[model samples]
Target: MTSDEEAFRRMVRGSEAAFAELFDRHSGAVYRYSWGLAESRDEVADIVQETFLVLWRRRKEIRLAGHSVLPWLLVCCRNTAYNHNRARRRSPAGELTEPKPGTHAWHRRVEQEQAVEELAWVREEIAALPDTERRLCDLCLIEGLSYDEAASALGISPSAARKRIQRARGKLRAAKTANL
Candidate 1:
């Protein structure tokens, strides 16, 4: 088998086969990474597709420090997923520019609205959690504190914090599933 570096070099030289080989090697991983980042199935597909598109566009500019290209691909996937999610969050439903809410479009729009409502309901539930669990969630999840930081502030071990967080997440997940 050719080295990943060699295939990448060929891809930079405009060899389509080299690109295809690289894509075949990495697309599954890219998709999984995107999905792990909380993208919907369709959005995960879009992120994977966009990651590859960015890779292809940057083939000439991408610099590989070692023999492995997988790290670069994973970074690209992470970045693409983050950007995609940020854009989605930034665009509230009311900002949608779609002209007409036709049959299929209206259905999709309603689904999106429901999803937004579901998210709001979940937030309310999180806020209603018992004191310690709620503090853990607010510190770690809402305030974006690291587990260590949140644990330290809460006077608990990191493991204990993790367990509480997991428990909290389970409650939220169960609520979501029961609704579904």
Candidate 2:
């Protein structure tokens, strides 16, 4: 079986089959995630389509640091649902079913928004880091490499790599406190 990375590389090179294969493998999960966030069947359909459209358009930008693309797809799903909600809010209110503020449905919506916000905030924080630090983060956090493995890959000692990761965590903490 081809790794997703290899299939994605083919996708970037304009292989429709590779893209379809990926879609087949993951669209069900994305749909379920979207359905949980969306209030309507139509909205759920839109979110799933938007998520895959993004995955296709941003093929080169995808950095599937892990074996599965599921996490990234979930992030895309959250972002698409958030965008859809914002657009719906800005547009004229349609005859739609929205949950009461204190209801379970409302809590699910809140949770979905929070997930999107958290992912965006993390991306922003990581992007603010120095290039080397960001690369280390992509390797260690996103790519799921051990500190020792990432260190060797980057020509650094394991301790140094670990220290950099620690610093990255400190930065996140500082940013979180500042935001609070």
Candidate 3:
């Protein structure tokens, strides 16, 4: 195998140095994917870490078919961000979710105000969900877990998780349209 491929294999074998090298190689691409999903730097950081964590956990299954690991990492980053967004929406007190801009503090407070207002609306909508449906949203959308992962987390089957998410989404859609 090529040197890069060899490195990938080493990474899969759970070498911390190998993992660090892999992280250095793919972090930029993963960050870009995360940024595309949400402008928040904090969110991007979380997604990157989560993606790498999953990769580390499933290293044996990962194959270095190409010279790059960008594609796999990007997919993981997207899913991670999706899960993060979903989880934020399920908070009980209906907290506002904003991507922490981190170093991008140049924007005016007016922009912050606008984002806060939008977040409030989102929180209210989520708060309107019934308990079961809200939990479904939490497991399915937040925490970046797959249907299986979410199901496992909630102690339900994957099929049940899928069904509950569908039903909850339908209610959310109906309620949203009612407001229009």
Best by TM-score: 2
| Superposed model 3: Cα runs more than 4 Å off | 1-3, 39-41, 92-180
Candidate 1 lDDT, tens digit per residue, 1-180? 578999899889876656866887889888778899845465888888888888889999999978878889889988888888888788744543663666788788889999999878977898788889988876766556799899998999999999999999999889879888
lDDT of 3 by residue, 24-121 (tens): 77788887788888545557778888899998898898875677776778777888898887776675345656555553553455588879886777
Q: Judged by lDDT relative to the true structure, which candidate is superior, 2 or 3?
A: 2
Lowest-sum lDDT 10-residue window in model 2: 13-22
Q: TM-scores of the models, in the given order?
A: 0.51, 0.53, 0.47
Worst 10 residues of 3 by lDDT: 98-107
**Candidate 2: how large is its RMSD?**
11.6
Runs with alpha carbons beyond 4 Å of true place in candidate 2: 1-7, 10-95
* Candidate number of the best lDDT: 2
As a whole number from 0 to 100, the lDDT of residue 36 in candidate 1 is 94
Clashing pairs in model 1, backbone N/Cα/C closer than 3 A: none
**C-alpha lDDT of residue 137 in model 3:** 65
Error of 1 at 127 (Å): 55
